[model samples]
Target: MYTVSVMEDFIAQHYLTVPDPGPEGEVHSHHYEAELTLSGPELDEYDYLVDIETVEEVLAVVRARYEDALLNEQSKFAGHNPSVEHFAHVVWDLAADELDTDHLSTLTVTIWEDDDTWAAYEESV
Candidate 1:
């Protein structure tokens, strides 16, 4: 399958809600990098997996919403842990809502909370 990916970086604050969260229980900032990958067996009429510029535009909005914001305050994160895993799904949901998926086979959201730590969520379109 062909894959097209776009990435955006932003800083966001959040505190874990799980028990014995320790230092993580306190709000902190993560220099996050989120990458969205679109995959399909076939390309569109223009022979593109999707338009890169269009994806970048969508990611710009995504970055704007999360940059310098507190994750726990967002409706999508309400009662959620705000962990990287959950964050990945949250981003995936937002991107999916804004992007056309009829021609795509799968969408994967990978988020790096730090240089070495990351999580991902993937699903069929």
Candidate 2:
């Protein structure tokens, strides 16, 4: 299988809603880095698994919605913990809307909360 990936970075604020949580329960900001990967056995007419420019544009739209904002307030996480894993799923959902599922066979979204930690969500055909 062949894969293609695109990455982007953005900043956002959020707080976890875990019971008796620690410092993460308090609102804080993160310099988030998100990577989206698509894979398939074949490429499109352009000889590419997917268009990098299209991926970039979609990522930009996603970033614009969350950049410099409180994710917990504006996202479905309003009453839940906005963990890295959850954020990955959010990114996947957003990107899924833009991808051409007809050609792509797999999708993975990775979200880095910090230099040492990250989470990912994946879907396969």
Candidate 3:
């Protein structure tokens, strides 16, 4: 299978809920990094599974929507914590909605809250 990835970084604030509430329970910013990966068994006539420019366009939208925003203020958070795991899925949904998935086999979104920690969500298209 062929795979392509697009990456971007943004700043956002969020708090976690579960077990003990610590400083993380307070709104804080993370230099978050997100990577979106598209994979398939075939490529188009242009020898690409997906257009890099298309990926960048979608990523730019995602970044613009979330960059410098308070995660808890977003509709997607509703009543849930804006955890990295949830963030990954949120990004996946946004990117999937913008892409033509007919030729793709899978889509995966990985979010890094810090250099040492990250989470991912993947789905078959």
State which candidate has the highest TM-score.
1
Candidate 2 lDDT, tens digit per residue, 6-116? 989999999888888788889899999999999999987789888899999989987998899898887556666788898898889889987777888899999999899
lDDT tens digits, residues 47-107, model 1?
A: 9989999899988988999999999999999989999999999999999999999999999
What's the ranking of the predictions by lDDT, best on top? Answer: 1, 3, 2
Model 3 misplacement above 4 A: none
Off by over 4 Å in 2: none
What is the C-alpha local distance difference test score of each model?
A: 0.95, 0.88, 0.92
112 in model 3: Cα distance from truth in Å? 0.8
Query: Which is the better candidate, 2 or 3, if ranked by TM-score?
Result: 3
lDDT-superior candidate, 1 or 2: 1
48 in model 3: Cα distance from truth in Å? 0.8
Model 3, TM vs. native: 0.96
TM-score-based ranking, best first?
Answer: 1, 3, 2
TM-score of structure candidate 2: 0.95
- Candidate 2 C-alpha RMSD relative to the actual structure: 1.1
Candidate 3 lDDT over 1-125, as tens digits, reads 99999999999888887668788888789999889999999999999999999999988888899999999899988888788999999999999999999999999999999999999999999
Off by over 4 Å in 1: none
